[model samples]
Target chain A: MSPLLTFFLWSLLKCVVVTVVLLIGVAYTVLLERKLVGRIQNRWGPNRVGPFGLLQPLVDGAKLFLKEELIPGNVYKPLFLIAPIIALGCALISISVVPFGGPFTIWGSPNLFQISDVNFGLLVILGITSIGIYGIALAGWSSNNKFSLLGALRSSAQMISYELALGLSLVGVGMRAGSLNLRVIIESQTSNKGLLSWNIFGGMQFFAFFLYLMAAYAETNRSPFDLPEAESELVAGYHTEYSSMKFAMFFMAEYANMITVGCVATMLFLGGWTSPFGNLVPMPHNTFLLGLVQAFGPIMWFVIKVFSFLFLYVWVRGTLPRFRYDQLMGFGWRVLLPLTILNIVGSSLWFAYHS
Target chain B: MLLIIFILFAGLCLAGAINLLLQTHPINSALSLIVVMVSLAVLYLTLGAEFLAAAQVIVYAGAIMVLFTFVVMLLNAGKEERTLGSFASWSVGFPAVAVILAVIASVLIKSQGLGTVHLSDKITSTQELSAMLFKELVLPFEVTSVLVLIAILGAVALARRGDGERKGGQ
Candidate 1:
């Protein structure tokens, strides 16, 4: 095959594989949240579907597929139909630049374990996320329901406010790594000192990480910051008018966003795909297992770090009470935003001194 | 291939601009404006300004347009009513626009030694762009930022004055 054709084919294959895996990961993250929240609340969650509810996400997908879709009479038809699609599409696209593992040769071409490794990967993610707010805002507006409109407005406002802090927090990391490319940032963290060199530890970005954590939870509309969708106030929030697959799309989008946030946090702060032990853990030299370990080991480490972040997400959701609207706004603007700015200045000063 | 992509985006950009003008509903018009902004970003990308393309999307289509939509949505602005031709718009607007276009077209046609863009895969990296902005053009950059700050403060002051008038009347 021609090299260009090989490149095109491999890229197409990688896109398909990564998207499928990410969707499945989204499904299982929902399951993980349910199971963990269940355990926290002293109950077993979805245990009957398969062994330990392994088949639950599949069953849930089928159930949502089989459910009847409803279209309200008063909706703005064009935007109503387009809203969920925009939501899901933006969620899926942000993962294209995330590197899951190191590069490997295939079809005489070396391919990184990503759909595309853009130079401005981090900024692309941020830009996509900013655009994602439109999905919620339009869904609410098109529905013509007052409750849905309120929910959408609140959600968009919250996301926009938190995005400033979130972006600023990562500025410190970008400065430390001296690149916005995700892979280069990870490589910068790789040293013999292992975990110490990671941004949250030795890089003195611990405070920025906390700010990012809070801002990210708000960005994704996760619990404790989920004032927009408070069931007692707004029926089901921005997705109130949606049903069946449309509703399912919004649900999937939310979980996918959670997973993406986890992936980004893993890449930026926790040292993406790199083993915490650094070179202390030796790779096996046996020929057959060597390739296996080399390819899968980084992936394993990446998965573990992301899983822990997800666990933290669920843990906080179960523990903390939801913030009031005013409190949420106040916290993001007054507290987190300033702290992130301070973090940026401090990181820049530290880097200057060291250099 | 690059020419084809550029043509496609440029066409989309023109289409979106026309749509923005034609759409009656505020929300639809706002969305069409977003499309215009995004296609312009793609055009910038084709010209190898990758960072500029991203910033255009993030700052214009994403942030500024969202605020525009928020205002329209909050005010519950309905579809615009059709109106008879306005005298000033028909007489002044068309001629002014035509004059500007004529000037631009004549410049393009008459100018010799004007450079043509050679489409290549090379990108202007963010580091180089930042270095140029911060080192060579630092004064202008800082001045532009301060100007924007002044505009924001002026807006705030005007809004505060409105609140003060309302309170005094009460």
Candidate 2:
């Protein structure tokens, strides 16, 4: 087979696998969030549904599937339908560039864990995340409801505000690493050291890291920054009028975005897949098996780090109160914006002073 | 294969442009504009400009198109039939001139053997593009930023005028 044909098939297969995995993961994430939050609140979450509510997500999935879908009489039918698909598709496309594990040999060919390792992987991810706003905006607008339009407008403004900080915060890391390829960034951290060598602990990169985390939380429309979908204000936010699986798709996109943000945080500041204290061990540096072991060492660590961040997201949801719309906007524009700018300048000065 | 993809993308662009021009509904025209932008991005990809293609989609199709759609919906411009001389005369005239110019330009390029022009693969990558933007195109890029700033200032001025008018009326 031609190389192009091989690449095409490999990408297609990876897409299929990732889609299936994310679907399952999304279902389970809902369960995990509820159970964790329930524990935090000292309340029973969903014990009625099969075995401590292990099957609650499945039941919820079934309910959404069986529920009657609604389209309001005045809504723009085509755009209303297309909006959720766009949201879900863009959410899924971002996973293509994320490296779940190191490369391995398969059928006498080098098989990489990522779908495609583009040189501009960081930029691509940023671009795709930015595009997700349209899905929310369109959904709200197409619904032809006042609440939906207001929600969409709020979401667009909120997303655009935070995205600036998010992009600027990453500039510091990108400058320090001298590469935007995520895999390269991960490899750089591995060769340098482990946890201490990661960008967050590497000099003043932590400031950018902090900014990124806050901006990322806002970007995903998670609680405290989820004013667009605040049930108390706009009913259900952008999906106010959506029912059945269409609503499910929006919910899936939100969790998928949460996972994407977590993965990106892992890659950027958490040493990606590198073991935290791998440098402490006196392993040989040149052996093939040792190299393989070292390469795969970070995968588990990466997942654990990402899961902790995901847990933080749920914990925050249970603990903190949502910000007022004006307060949220002010925080994003006034606080995070200047802080991100300072991070860039500080990183640049450090680079100049050191090198 | 590249040519095939290019032709298909071109067809989509043509269809979208026609829909935008001939359709009576402003909302339909806005949607068609999005289709045109997407097709343009595909055309960029066919030329091996992947970064450019993604930027085209993100900036034009995703951002600007959304703004256009929003404004169209906000205006709530209802459907109306296109009369014979209702903006069609200028539009048709410009397109006719554009076609004539395109035909002349293509003939000149063909006669000059410009079809043999080649682009080196190295110069097409994102790194090279960044280098070119910051180094060679720095002046023009900075000028564009200034232009955008001026446009924003003008918009603010116009908004202030509108507010002043409302206050005067009250």
Most accurate candidate by DockQ: 1
TM-score of each: 0.96, 0.88
Candidate 2 achieves a global lDDT of 0.83
For each candidate, give the TM-score of chain B.
0.88, 0.77
lDDT of each model, Cα atoms only?
A: 0.91, 0.83
Candidate 2 pairs with clashing backbones:
A273-A298, A274-A298
DockQ of each: 0.69, 0.41
Per-residue CA lDDT of model 2 for A1-355, tens digit only, reads 9877877887788778878887887888888899989999999887899988889998999999999988889898988999999899889889889887766656433455677888778878887887788789889888989889888888877887888899889987787677888888887777545678788886468888889988998989999798989999899989999999999999999999988898999898887877788568777677987876756765678778878888989998999999999999999999999999988888999988987
Give candidate 1's error at residue B127 in angstroms. Answer: 0.8
Residue-wise C-alpha lDDT for candidate 1, range A1-355, written one tens digit per residue: 8888988888888899999999999999999999999999999988999899999999999999999889999999999999999999999999999999987765565665888878999999999998999999999999999988999889878988898899999998999888989999999898988899898997889998888999999999999998778899998899999999999999999998998999999999999988889889777889879999888999999999989989999999999999999999999989999999999899999999997
Off by over 4 Å in 2: A1-5, A282-296, B86-123, B160-170
